[model samples]
Target: MKRTIRLAASIAGLAGTIVLAGPPTTIINFDTYPDGSAVQPTDAFTTQYSTVGVEFNGPGPSGNSCSISPPNHAYAKRIVASFVDPCTGVASVTSYAGTAQDSCWVPGEGIDMFAYDRDGNQIGHEFNAGGGHFTAFSFPQPVIARLDMYCILQGIDNLAFIAPVPVLRGDLNCDGAVTSSDVGPFVLALIDPSGYAGAFPSCDIRHADMNCDRRVDGLDIQGYIDAIFPP
Candidate 1:
């Protein structure tokens, strides 16, 4: 059964608004992959999983190397002799805010996990030092785009993450309301997307896709006007 957790306290301010509900949670347990299949390399796992909103990378001095163990579990192979310096595992999501996972480590081996935002800022981090058992690690915040895991000979399973919330249509300013105030930003999104993003770093320019054709062009102008000045 899927488990649901409470939203982080940081986003509590969005309550009583159209953004009250949190984004859906997704879990990748590695069981779907064929037994003992490779999990790294763009073609093997990254590309296939990106469609589901997550990307994986296992980088080492040699090359990327990770695989699925029997039954279910993502095992990172040790490319170096010392357990202290192990392979690095990276999982990236599209504007995700938080992530968690169940991990198993060898005796005296553990993992260090770090979360980064869209701008490459470190938003959260967690570390587990003990070993020989499963441990649940989590980093909940408001915006996370990447997760880096460092461990030696560890097994990772049940990776869970919260997807990014969809931006409200026509709410270019992300103020939870579509009003006249969005006019300038909407025009900016249609004309100069980069400028619009710079003007509102927390807002999604795609909100200006008033016609829902996947682009903010001249076709959306009438719809946007109608939203701001309803008849």
Candidate 2:
């Protein structure tokens, strides 16, 4: 659960705090909507920040210091590192720009969050795991009522933590992966007929997708056979 705390942060002497860039909102605290799917609206957690308070507190950008203090009134999905404009409700963002500090994911990391208009045109994106937070993107010049969010996190152990929690959040078959192959075809059929390939509990072979194609097909079967062969 994304439980929020509001405790005063206990910082030891000489703790460095430097300005950084980022996003600062956490959402879907206790639901199964990693892609914000079926993400219901809850009370808004607002912070009055500005370009004046943009700062970072970690070894470097992309640092895993996601935390908040007085952890009661609200909670941050990860520690606040920085902000885009720091004043406006964020619309665009990035994380861990090139610097001396080496990236944990080699050439660097980009846990991307994509926002799109209803027409499926990308309006904005945030690198570095939504800038270690989330952005509020609106479609059609910020007037459209709906803007969809989808994300990809690399080297995020938090993803591992959330995986077993169940819910639609565990849908690894997203990205049409569940529909990338025969299994996807099956899901399409399930969506259409509801009693076809998925009629049997044992037939939900979505995971049978071995090529990351998100399907159960001849390729997957061949992959399985490949695994059994001598290297």
Candidate 3:
């Protein structure tokens, strides 16, 4: 089914707080397989970059039809999921992040499903599975070009990746609004680039640099604060 999911609320701190929205649920059904064995699904998707294919955790049950569902009641810039033999092994899907390595993910180990951006950043992840349930992941910003999944000791059936929604430019904290809360993430970006970028992959540095000074420092802090919360 063709649909779109947008973020209605801002994400929490670097800890990751999925802000659910009231957008339509998008579904990527992989039920069009040829009921056979295949290393990767032939269902290639056309993205901004070159086309990409769906990757499985390993050479599992040839070809199987499955579906991926995004977070329920969550406002996400982008969402992705992999359909595999639930709790069997690690199943995953890969998609195109973008040309630039400006993607990031919330870090977690031993997750049932996980996503990494073009820059090799773990944008999202989930742990454990209850049967062949639909395990999904979300990204703060839309910089996900390639998505990959794993479960530890299982195989995957199929993979599906969704399109990106819209996002406010300077909403660093992703609280649906750019207010004082953004200051924490903005400052984090300035002190620890890697940590900040990885935690809030969607928070573009350029947007955080309110004064357009090409840097996220104390200098831009004031401008950012004023711009979002103007007097």
Q: Each candidate's root-mean-square deviation in Å?
A: 11.6, 19.3, 16.5
lDDT of 3 by residue, 159-192 (tens): 4344333234466766678777777787787788
Q: Which ranking of candidates, highest TM-score first?
A: 1, 3, 2
lDDT of 2 by residue, 1-231 (tens): 223222223232213232122323232222223334331234332222212222222211132333211111122233332332222222223321211111223234344444333255655555543233323332223222122222133322221100011112112233322223344444443354345344444333343444544444555555444433424
Better of 1 and 3 by lDDT: 1
Could you tell me the TM-score of candidate 2?
A: 0.21
Candidate number of the best lDDT = 1
* Model 3's TM-score against the true structure: 0.30
Alpha carbon lDDT of each predicted model? 0.52, 0.30, 0.40
Candidate rank order under lDDT = 1, 3, 2
lDDT of 1 by residue, 1-231 (tens): 122234544345555452454455455555553234444423233323333455566322112123222344444542111010001112223333322223443465555666666577776666645433333323444456666766655555545556443446788888999988888988888889999989999876767766655567998899888888888
- Cα lDDT, model 1, residue 213: 53
Per-residue lDDT, model 2, residue 152, is 31
For each candidate, give its TM-score against the true structure.
0.47, 0.21, 0.30
lDDT of 2 at 125: 56
